[model samples]
Target: MAVIANAKVETLPEPWSGAIRSGRHQLITDKPESFGGQDQGLAPYDLICSGLISCTMITLRMYAQHKGIDLGAFQVEADFCTNKEGREWIERRVHFQSPPDEALQHKVLDICSKTPVTKTLLRSLEINTQLV
Candidate 1:
């Protein structure tokens, strides 16, 4: 059984700090001074959205390749935001830009749903956090 899990622990204060890792990729993060960070790498919110977008595009490409579908010309663009519905994240808008096709729009959307990040976000999650 293959399991995918990410762990990030706060490693700094003020600007905030954390080390996040997934698969073979590991990264440290902080916010900009404007947001309490020292103008480090990507912002936390950007990281979150980018993770999802990457998974969606990768999954789409993988699925297309498997079915002998040509994806050399495939393209995708994704955007998202954090919006709490009363108290929880109940609504999200994932905009995508791919080759327009009347018959393929549904197929592409279906493939996107199978992305790991999509599944993870749509499913319940358990996060343990505390001040360091």
Candidate 2:
């Protein structure tokens, strides 16, 4: 497995505005003005969802290509909600421009659940923090 350890984020003067760096790419993150941010870019939850969605789609595409399966255009929508119980649930809807067979659809669904981000989210996280 490839490791990504160089990702970093720096806070800007604006509240909740962060400059994120990953390799040669950079992105901005901020919350809505109602949450005391400038609303410049995706919030934390949106970034998480984006990771999961991107991973899922990439995994499926690789699998289909490797297996010589003709998976046409597709789209995925994911929603995240947390309740009083502190439980977070992510609901995802996937649609294909040309629907595949039931077997292929099931295979794709299975692969989506196994995406790196999806698996990581489902498993317990062990974070060790330190101040340099």
Screening candidate 2 with a backbone cut-off below 3 angstroms (N, C-alpha, C), the clashing residue pairs are none
Pairs with steric clashes in candidate 1: 15-36, 31-37, 32-37
Judge candidate 2 at residue 32 and give its lDDT. Answer: 91
Query: Highest TM-score: which candidate?
Result: 2
lDDT of 2 by residue, 12-60 (tens): 9998999999999999999999998999999999988888888888888
lDDT of 2 at 13: 93
How would you encode candidate 1's per-residue C-alpha lDDT over 8-127 as one tens digit per residue? 545755457666666678777877788767766667666777778777777877777888876555444544544566443423234444454656678877777777887888898887
Q: Give the TM-score of candidate 2.
A: 0.93
TM-score of 1: 0.67
TM-score of each: 0.67, 0.93
Q: How big is the positional error of residue 84 in model 2, measured in Å on the Cα after superposition?
A: 2.1
Compared with the true structure, the alpha-carbon lDDT of candidate 2 equals: 0.89
